[model samples]
Target: MKTTTIRTDLPREEKRKGAFMILTFFGIMATAGFLAMSIDLGVVAVFKVRMQNVADAAALAAAQEISIALDEISDQISSGNVQGEVQDANSYAQDQARVMAEHVAELNGMFIDPQIDVLFGQRTLDENSGEATITWGVSPFNAVKVIVRKDNPSQTAPDAKVDLFFAKMFDNDQVALRAEAVAYIDSRDLVVVMDFSGSMVYDSLWRSDSIDKLGQQAIDDGLYNIWTDLDSPTYGNMQFDNDWITIPSDSSSSPKVSLTWKKSTVDITTTKQLDYARLYFSDNKYQNFSSLSGQSKTLSGTGSNSGKLIKYAKVRYKENGREYYADFDLFDYDTLKRGLDLNGVNYPYPSGSWNSFISYCLNDSEVNRAGYRYQFGMMNLVHYWLDAQMPYSSTPELWKTRHYPFNAVKSGGSLLCEFLDGLDFGDHLGLVTYDTYHRVESQLVPDGWVSESVDIGATPITDDYSAIDTIQKHKQAAHYYNTTNVGGGLHEAIKLLDEHSRYGSQKTILLMTDGNANTSDNNWSVPSDFSWNAMTDYNGDGVADYTTSDSHKLYTFVRVKQAIDKGYTIHTMSVGANADRDFMKAIAFAGDGIWVDVPGGTTVAAMEEQMLQAFARIAANVPPPKLTHSESP
Candidate 1:
């Protein structure tokens, strides 16, 4: 009965069940096989990727090492060639490669038990090429190879590799990793331009708006801060009206060594001599007396001008207890300070203190000279200042000239006056203004000293502008404000820099101005003929022609030549809405200098920071070479 009933229907269910069993067996087997394949594939991929990474890193490391070694080798070879030594260049190259490889491997992580194989592939009379191979195994059966080919005259890529774990299952060969890199030796000597301007002044100001300095002690501290922050021993500084005092006297002064008033006496040998003149007031003029009587008087003369007295004073210094007064018969409006000395002899007056205390009446000879008339006032002040500043020493003989003390004095004027006037203008004026323009001729831009001449001839101000009144005007303004022609100052700096370059010493020029350079083409001209384009070859061809343009005229060749002649580098920082950005950039480019924008005006801290950064950057660029090692084959 059951068997009879289950015949056909049971046959269908049983057949279906049988089919399911067969399908499940096949599915299970397929799933297991697929998972096994995936696991193996994943393992192979990870190993391949890891090995490739090692190869790439090793190759890069090897290439970098090779590059550095090659640079040293090249230098050594060049040195040998210069000495006419026939060296085995091939041996040198192999040694370098092996050393580089080993050193690189040491720097790598401990996980990479890398093996380096270096080979001297080929060589020529003046060139060589080599290969550095790095190999590391991921597993017992997996390996990666990286090749770094360093060729002379031309370098090749760094090769890297990645391997599949089971790739070797198909063939008994391990996978290869590939990566490439190329490198070359830098053959140019880097030239640095550092900023050494007094605006780099770090001290806080009392009336930051006025020259009446309050916290000089604070200023001294700031200055020391600045001094300490200066990165390089090699630098040039310019203080608008002070002497160019260099620091570290042993360093070369070829490129117009410019330091400010704080430099030691031994630093800058040259000084802006102060003007000295014996000013005489007639007894009548000194005591409300009228016109001077035309007369001849005799007195003594000493030192270089030592001779018989040709003139005499009608009055002498009278001691009225606490105050010393000169007795003159007449003190009149027309009467001006006269140049007379201890001998009572009238002498040509220069600015700064006159050594002689003798007073004298004005002779006809005094009024006869044209220059003596207008300069008489300045002459008197110079004599007074020098007497107060350097009371002990006998005035130097150079003071006799019209530009004496101003040309001879070491540190001249107050710091406020110098920065306000313009750093370049101050340096050019140097001892001239400080000493009161005694030996002006000596300060004349020397002939081969500069690479170019600044056409300051077009300047309207041929007369000395170092008067206390004039200086006071600048000192009263913000450090970043300018009431004068910055263009002229920049141009002057260039010419001066060129002059310093001639002495086989490098120079750096720093200029800071509040206003843009004069855009007046009518009054200014770039001295192209005498200008040295610093961006070009020192001999003058790598850059474009230096031209005169109203927009770009301020820091043209005339100004830059001074730095170029002395192998100087110039750095300029400024504050002003009208400041010439393009011109500043050009000056920076030409002088190998930098131009910084003091966004918040020229604050003592901001200016100092900018200058410090510039100095550090320069120092970094010229850092001395350091030694490192690598593997070799």
Candidate 2:
């Protein structure tokens, strides 16, 4: 504006300031562009992670559904509810798997229906190579692979993609992503080492609070129960001493001598006996007479109505005269038909005082051939629980052949099959029972025997398992007697797994007992000079090394360690109060397994409940579904 008094220094300063302003503007523009690019990249990265999470979650859900559906199909095959094979089951499982995957994907912020691919197959381990191989579209489909993606369209929705928040300016707003997973229902091998000791079948109340009144007592050191009129010495309704009776043939006279008795108090040397005259016709009618009184004359049809004969009477005898004159039963039932069995024993029962207590076992219904399960719980009476279609009747000394606890064990084993079926995986099961002798009933059997005929070693049939356990259990339970050799049982179980277990599968020993370890390999009858507390080697060679309780317990641990050393878990179960608790817990601890003790209550219901729960826990002991692999689709 006004004067032209310009200096050379002022012009130079103005030029420098202009250069500084231009450099600052360029640096600010470059920084803003870089910040925008970084923000767009961050948005894409975050959404990519979220899409991968959704895919993984969806794949897991699909695999889980497939596993559950396969389980249902197996159940249907077992119960004969549906006549379908594993391939048929796979069809349904895959379909539902797709649905489950979509549902899960949606739940995890995937608003669109994502592309899901589900495939059913079997995952097997190569025995020689020790590697797992997945084969698709197999018969026993136990493995499922799921692939979830956002790039493909579904029937109800368009393609799904991870949207970028800050990349819109660059016209790159979305990214396609996918995930995959393979879940295998892994296989397991279990050997049920059960206790079949004689004590397993004791009377339900044998261990009760008020056992004196109704419970059965074990005799011969818990080997058997005679149940010899245990209520009292003065029991009621004994069989008539039929040696005195001379039954006539059917074609006897009109006033036929069908049955007869005479009065002679000789060997039956009770003081005041029979009255020989107090006869009962039935519950409604009875009258006293002296025809069968004095010398020898209680003849047929004496002191009785025509059609209704003497059903019961009291004769005081069969005693060593140590107690009072207690009168017991005399009867005219069909059991008194006076015949010998093929074994030369009395046909219906034994002779005289042994049959003296038979009437106490007989109820009003059994006396009439009606049914026998209600009265006194038919204690040692008849085995028919209310129906004639039930198994064989209860006979003296036949509690081993027919009872509830052993039957409960068999049924409980069947329940294990049910649980195994629920696993939807192929499994092998074996059996070993220990009493005085430990016998292997069956070798490893597959849970899904796909063949028409059941054959072990690789085939499986829940029915296959069912049939084997059925036949073997009955055969072995018939001999549930003598001592408990837990060591021997574990030894057998370990051998079974060692020989039959499949490679890349779990080998497990489920050792069950209702008693302590008593019988070592040797059945000791004579006491050898050995310490009762030490783990003794009687012969000093290490075979049959256990001679006492402590030694037997240690020997059991030694057997358990064989499986442990081979990478197997030993799960211990105790089914009764008398079971060896400390040893069971210790062995389980040593093998890094679980110890479960189910209280053996005093009834069949309780036994059933205990075994069911115990096996259920054992079933749960399997490792959770094997997440075999996860990867990009």
Candidate 3:
């Protein structure tokens, strides 16, 4: 009591200092409280940002999964494997979407179960506001919507709570967050135009049997059998079938062979037996011998001994105890052997046997005639080589037989089928082949679209598999033909896409060829007057004037331009050496698409691989599903 009595009499300065301390203590407490509130808000803000990021990822993942699920269901329905119900399909897609969302959310630090929602539908433009609104229960089921939530109290399984540090002083333990995203799959209509021209059948390894035999002989003999002296003036007389007529030495004109007499060294009394006989001939025809009396006389010999009888006239001579014969045709022996002597055709003495000589001339002539003229037709060495490589029945018509290298079209078609198998469900595909004419093998239909024509009991196409099956059947039935009609194929492709493609879908043409446009007329479906250039009104009078005819390339260019104007993109692929790269590139450029060149290879397998790679590349380049919207609602 005594110590507290004098406290009120302190100086004014001291009292003021004490009051300031009390106010400062209250102010410090207030500042701490405010700091704690800010900490809490900062923690909540960070958590919201993190949760929003997670929601975006989850939504995108869920949307993609839903799209895939819907595609599977559509494929099943189109394949006839299942009669798809919109409700069941949507339910399945939603389940997939939820699973994907939860999985993605968990990957992004969401430990507790996150709230997820999915919708399968279409996005349509609002006519009034020009805004897009997602509408559910639409045919084709091309759209998906996903919503992800964190710590949402309304959700049965809310997202994991975001713990607070400094905010704990304020009793704020966690925060709630949510995000939504919408995704849609765009429809694509694609047409594939293939070229099946005559050149498509060309194979470098293709040879005839005759050529092979001659080539083998040349290899064995170490000499090229081709006649190099064919231009020689005496070459015609060397022919085995040439008629040789020689006149006796006494005949006027000129003697082809002159006679000379020599005294016999051993028998001087009998004199050399007409040592050598000489004969003369006019031109290549036989000249009658005129005796010393100026009377015409013919000398002939008969014998079945194997010898090439060049001329009808023959001369006989006696030596020792044997009689020998010589034909007037033998007079040309010196000239014939002049060039052939180096090879093996040897004419020994004038009385030598002609057996070997005859055989050599006949074989040489056969090889020369057949090899130089390519007279082996389909059975030439090329054919023989092809046969050895690819065995088949030795049918009369070899070209008609299907073989490895010749099956390029089939291989290409098979690759196309493989590509088709990978197409997204709901994408429409059309097939067309061009030669002298263009044929629509298959009309544009959804990737899941199927027909009883392909498989009677097959389930409607519900997915890409059935669509691929349909395409496979068409490919199998396709056959190669003669001319390349690019314009006709393009025309048919456009018609098919226009007739069967759904509105608002992407239209594309996959044009493949091994050659340039070779046909001028569009004889597929259009009339003659409306064929190619005839259909274009160049003067702008709206009337097709046939004044100037258009080339195949120009006509095809026009068609490509028209298709491009109609919102069609053309992707062109060239195969083999004959393919026109520039032309195809031009078409692709005009159509606003890509151009692929599938180079030829040394081997059939290599070629097939190149083709497969080309097709795969094209498939990969196909327009992918674009996300029109990727934001939370």
lDDT: which is higher, 1 or 3?
A: 3
What TM-score, computed on C-alpha atoms, does each candidate reach?
Answer: 0.28, 0.54, 0.45
Superposing all C-alpha atoms, what RMSD in Å does each candidate have to the true structure?
22.2, 14.2, 19.5
Across 168-276, the per-residue lDDT of candidate 2 in tens digits comes to 6668666676655676666677778887765554433233321332233321112112233222111122222112333332322222222233321111222222224
lDDT of candidate 2 at residue 212, scale 0 to 100: 35
Order by lDDT, highest first: 2, 3, 1
- Encode model 1's per-residue lDDT on 1-633: one tens digit a residue: 355444565556766787899899999878876775676667656655554444455444443443343234322221113112112322343354445544553454212322344332211011012222212221110012233322222112232233334444445223343222222111111112111111211122222331232233443333233223322111112221212212221224221111111211111111221111132322212112222222211222333334322211222121222212221211221111221111233333232323321121122222222112112222222322222222112222211221211111111122212221221111122111101001111222323322222333332122232432132221111112212344445444444333322221223445554344432223554555653344533335555543444543543445465555555566655443334565566666676766665432333444334433332232212111111122211
lDDT of each: 0.30, 0.51, 0.49
| Deviation of model 1 at 611, angstroms | 1.7
Alpha carbon deviation, residue 68, candidate 2 (Å): 9.8
In every candidate, how many clashes are there? Answer: 104, 8, 31
TM-score: which candidate is best?
A: 2
In model 2, the runs with Cα more than 4 Å from the true position are 1-146, 152-175, 204-404, 421-423, 443-463, 476-481, 522-549, 630-633
